[model samples]
Target: MIQKLQKKLEGKLPGIESWKRMAVKSGKGESIESESLQKYSDWISKDKLNDMRKAAVLIGLFKKNDEWCFSLIRRPMNEKNHPGQIALPGGAREKNENLMNTALREAFEEVGIKPEDVQIIGQLTPIPVPVSEYLIYPFVGVIDYEPEWVINEDEVEELFILRMSELISSDNGYTETWDLRGNKVEVPIFKVMNETVWGATAAVLSELIDIAK
Candidate 1:
């Protein structure tokens, strides 16, 4: 399965056009996105586009108990952004650093993934996160074996090993009403373990899932 996904990803990615339709288009003709991720239409407004910073995340895949799996982390609740949310290991790009290095570096800092241990296979669509003013690039990588994680307490609250097959097979998506800032809004999410994943992280994962299919 991993090899198949890697091969498909290498040739061509289902890019931003598909992602925009999936993320923002309201099947009901109601404006679900304008209330939430309206930036899917333009990534960022023209004026703020130039000011957006770059970030990257890793979808680190490995085999465990003869099954393919991937790693995810939950941020500490005290975090200023996306606190308590499950996410791919990643952070902002540093000065003079490339986005792929940002993904690998942040993965190492947050979860002890050695850069040499991962074979980067391909990348998914880059998504713009308006709330955080970030253009997030997501990379897919494979490691030969499951890792004994060394977690950074400052960045990670918990770690999860999710079965890649289960994610491919299960009904992982659902919607719920959330109070964002002050407005009551409906949000789409992926139910992973006991956690709810939404926003930019979910958007990235959604694209990954589509590619895996």
Candidate 2:
């Protein structure tokens, strides 16, 4: 599965335009984001979004239990934003750092993955997150085997190494109504490790799934 994904990634990526087609519909042609997007319209526009702070995340795939798997981290509950949320290992760009380096460095810090061990396949579309004011660039990488995860407790509460097949399964995807800020909206989510995966993280995985397909 990882080899298949690597080959697909070598060519054209689905990008955010493909994400719109795949992520927007909740199996009923109803958009999960229309309401919240309008609320953030002032900054969510293409021009304004390009000016937002940049961040990057790594979808680190490895072999486990004879299957292809990847990593996700649960943030500490005390985090100022997105507390307790599950995410790919990543953070905001640092001074003089390129986005890919930002992803590699942050992964090493958050989950103890050696940058030298991870062979990057390529990058996926950048997902604009209006609420956090970040344009998140995602890169897919592979390691031969899973490492002994040394979680940075200050940033990561837990690390989950989940099967890529689980991600590729359609049964994990669903939508539910959630109150964002003050408005209730239908939120598309993926149930992974019995935890909710949504927002920009979900957007990244959605495209990865499309690429693998």
Best model per TM-score: 1
Question: For each candidate, what is the lDDT?
Answer: 0.78, 0.80
For candidate 2, the TM-score is 0.85
**lDDT (10s digit) by residue, model 1, range 1-213:** 777888878876665543443343343535455544555445344555446698999999999999889899999999987889888899999998988999999999999999889999888877777667788899999999887799999999999988877665643447777676766666677776777777777777777777788
Per-residue lDDT of 1-213 in model 2, one digit per residue for the tens?
A: 667877888887766544553344443557766554553455545466656799999988888888888899999999877898889999999977999999999999999999999989888877777568788889999888897788898999988888978887844548777766675666778887898888778878888888887
Best by lDDT: 2
RMSD of 2: 3.6
Worst 10 residues of 1 by lDDT: 18-27
User: In model 2, which regions exceed 4 Å deviation?
Assistant: 21-50, 170-173
